[model samples]
Target chain A: AQSVTQPDIHITVSEGASLELRCNYSYGATPYLFWYVQSPGQGLQLLLKYFSGDTLVQGIKGFEAEFKRSQSSFNLRKPSVHWSDAAEYFCASKGNTDKLIFGTGTRLQVFP
Target chain B: EPEVTQTPSHQVTQMGQEVILRCVPISNHLYFYWYRQILGQKVEFLVSFYNNEISEKSEIFDDQFSVERPDGSNFTLKIRSTKLEDSAMYFCASSANSGSYNEQFFGPGTRLTVL
Candidate 1:
């Protein structure tokens, strides 16, 4: 079974500071990785995805993630954090069966 | 851009009652999925539908739960004899196809509260 692990349960960053959320996955083959964000009372929004080719994938809201196959990691990063970026972020990986398994998620808190 | 939409933004039902959550997937999407997030937990896939049949389902999707695309655009999940454990945010997602490159678009989600 494919699974995702987000080591950080919560992350805090100051406005304009850099942010990085860790994600790791366990799958037999090359996995389809994705990052999603959910604001309070809103639906989950896709940040970005990685299927093949380039190791670094860019996403909406100035967020990006790098798929490190050797590390089994797809960590999300933002150069500068904004207050609006505070939300729950989830990392997911699609298995060969095409089912997306999600990580426990990291709740980001941005302070001024 | 087209997006998925779910109905009954919030539904509160009594235990043992049946509840149906509806969704209108993207007009051109061919694959539909249902997922749920229990409070403070990760979202778990329940079932995936394509060609009007279930293609994949997780153990979380048991006999008490069923999915149907009764019409052209509507995809619905029905839970029979709901339990308090069923309380969670139920989300509907759709993808253009099963291709690995395609991404699934998620709906706002329906908050189901079983009392």
Candidate 2:
């Protein structure tokens, strides 16, 4: 079985500051990782995905994540945060079954 | 950009009643799936449909839950008896039926509230 863990349940950051959201997964083989953002009462919006090849994958909304196989981590990072970035972030990973297992999620509150 | 589409953006049903959620996947896509996110929780997979049949489903997708592609373009999720716990955002997603790499396009989601 595969599972995902997002260490931070909630995070608050000031606008223009760098941000990092941690994500770790437990899977037997190489994991297919993804980051999704959900606004209040809305459906998920795909942020990015890392399947194979390049470890560092860039995504929309000025976000990116690096896949560290040995550490079993795919942490999301941004150089600077914007107030609009405040939302719930979820990290999901899939393998051979192609079934996505999502983490608990990290609530980001960006303040100006 | 081509994207998945879902109907009845919101549905309110009484407990123990049957509720069906509908979706229209991208025209070129071949694989479809249904996922739900309970309030303040992660999105959980319910089932995956492909080739006019079910390819996979999670434990949460028990006997009470079923999916069907009734026609050429519609995919639907039917819950035999709606429970209060079933009130959540139901999302329909689709991909090109190739592999796990191509990102899945998601619909706006149907917010089901069972009272």
TM-score, prediction 1: 0.98
Candidate 2 C-alpha error for residue B21, in Å: 0.5
Number of backbone clashes in candidate 1: 0
lDDT of 2 by residue, A61-89 (tens): 99999999889999999999999999999
Off by over 4 Å in 2: none
Q: Which stretches of candidate 1 lie above 4 Å from their native place?
A: none
Worst 10 residues of 1 chain A by lDDT: A92-101
lDDT of 2 by residue, B1-115 (tens): 8878898999999999999999999998998999998877788999888898898998889988999999989999999999999999999999986566757878999999999
> Residues A26-92, candidate 1, lDDT per residue (tens digit)?
9999899999999999899999999999999989999999999999999999999999999999999
Best by DockQ: 1
Q: Which structure among the candidates has the greatest lDDT?
A: 1
Per-residue alpha-carbon lDDT of candidate 1 for residues B23-95, written as tens digits (9 for 90 to 100): 9999999999999999999999999999989999999899999999999989999999999999999999999
Docking class of 2: medium
What is the DockQ (computed on Cα atoms) for candidate 1?
0.82
lDDT at residue B58 of model 1 (Cα atoms): 90
